[model samples]
Target: MSCQPQYKGQVYIWLKNKQTCLLCGETTDTPQPICTPCESELPWLGDQCGRCALPLPMADLLCGQCATRPPAYERVLAPWAYDFPIDSLITRFKHQAKWPLGRLLGQLLALSLQHHFDEGLERPDALVPVPLTTRRLRQRGFNQASLLARWLGTVLQIPCAENLLRRVQDTPAQQVLDARARRQNLRQAFAMMADAPVRNRHLALVDDVLTTGATAQALARLLLDAGAARVDVYCLARTPKPGEPA
Candidate 1:
């Protein structure tokens, strides 16, 4: 039950108060950096698979893949599809170390999550970020998932278990792999720490995006096997099926 904190500073406070739209360079009056029009025009996820959050043609329907074989996680909640501007924004934040962009996305995600919470979606007892391998951590200097989980935990008032999970193997990046290959790549990749919090409590996994969902499936399976009562996923966006329209 450890707390993950938010950044505090005059600059952070200023950003939290009011800001300009990052997408169009327009001055916005709201606390969120993105203005209303840009926010509305973002590639929002409309109908999606209830289990995996795969963009779907209709609401309240499971995608064929989920119907055939449901994932280990209970469900996924994402505000947008990983398309054009969202994809680009995430890329910049992840690769370029753009802290403000990351915080903007995190704040928007927190609002989406709060709406769900108000509508009676069960909140988890803790948030656990999908971990990065030591090699990758050294290479990147940060784990984006850990940062997202910390921001979400701070905004949502939940404890974040940052070290509860560990990546034991430095597997190939999932982005370049297809679904089946991604599953194979993640085999025996993650481990739980000695003081891991995984028993009988509802937990949520936070990450940047849900691509093939292989990483989420593996982590959720691990948590469930370790006696977690329930597990859910919260991510900024969900990538649609390959060759599908945005």
Candidate 2:
């Protein structure tokens, strides 16, 4: 019986990992979709800010913003620059409730973070999703960040603290705001869950995309204030500075 279960488990994983490319509809028998050619053409991030993962002209450099005013989190890690198909995928996954697309992105993110951990990246004690407001939650019927965090936690063997934080205020959607406005809009927008036991534990915040980073700074500051040893941010893609070519 034990051997039969093991065999079935292997078959399940094999079938789950093999799928056609989600983008091009090409047949693929690999662990993740998008296929080799489609993935190679994806806007992988190049040189970036050591802190925010914002694409920069050079490596080993911090963007002027991070230099002038350091963010509360330790750093941001992302594999792709938000552009073209990535943005489209995130839009469909988040706004259209496309679970398969979300799964693909989450798996790719898990692989990237796993590679970093193998190379000595400090593993976090828990993964937290940037919580959605109650109203937004009702409208969306799902939290993309929470889903991504759970997927990453499962693949990385890390625990996910999906309820560690909650949105206290339903501030306007930040997609329309400038960086300065985003900061102001998110002030006191989030609060830690009561008795979350965050003291001295490292945590990483997971999200679909990281843009102005106002949301991350606010959440990281909350965790740090609650005595977290460290905080990091993870996202599938990081946006280039506004008006800059990707």
Candidate 3:
């Protein structure tokens, strides 16, 4: 179990009190909720395929690929696209060590959840974040997805389970790889822990971003194989196929 630090202070209280972009570290005298320029720059998901969450032509509700090969996870809910300031925000948060920025992203994710509920979506029984490799955890000092999951749980009134899945293998980063490569890289990388307290639960697997649905599919496969009844993905952002027509 991860040790909880003495309740020092609320994270949002700290960020909202300061006048800098929690994501990009840019200073703003009055950041518009989350830096106006930053929020505007965030890639919004519009007309995305319901199955995989990839952007689709307005005429077509389902992308051709998803229609051909549906993913294991039932559905994906992505509020934003992975581009521009959102890209910069995620890059900084994950790579440059901007940990506090996750709270800002979490707020957006919470709002998205409310919107989802309003649209008659069923809430998950538990929030389970995509597991990080132990190697990465030691290097980064935190898991952004886990932090987001905690916030998501608080907002949705669902419990967050941090250790339902374990990253058994330290796979290569997905960004530098192609679709097939990404799938292969994550194969057997994750496993449902036998000792995990989650079983037969409707789970929402949270991640910072969703690109090809590869990671989520892989993790979902493990969960189902281990007896999870259903797994849905909840991501902060989804990346459109590079250079694809909007």
Tell me, by TM-score, which candidate is best.
2
Q: Could you give candidate 1's per-residue lDDT for residues 50-146 as a string of tens digits?
A: 8988988989999999999999999999999999899999999998999788889999999999999999999999999989988888988898988
Worst 10 residues of 3 by lDDT: 28-37
Tens digits of lDDT, candidate 3, 80-108:
87876677778788878776666778877
- Model 2 segments beyond 4 Å from truth? 1-18
What lDDT tens digits, residue by residue, belong to model 2 across residues 154-239? 99999999878999999988999999999999999999999997999999999999999999999999999999999999999999
RMSD (CA, angstroms), candidate 2: 3.3
Computed on alpha carbons, the lDDT of every model, listed in order, comes to 0.91, 0.93, 0.82
Error of 1 at 3 (Å): 33
Clashing pairs in 1: none
TM accuracy, model 3: 0.84
Model 2 vs. true fold: TM: 0.93
What ranking of all candidate models by TM-score puts the best one first? 2, 1, 3
Q: Tell me the deviation in Å of residue 133 in model 2.
A: 1.0
Q: Per-prediction TM-score, please?
A: 0.92, 0.93, 0.84
Q: Find the number of clashing residue pairs for candidate 1.
A: 0
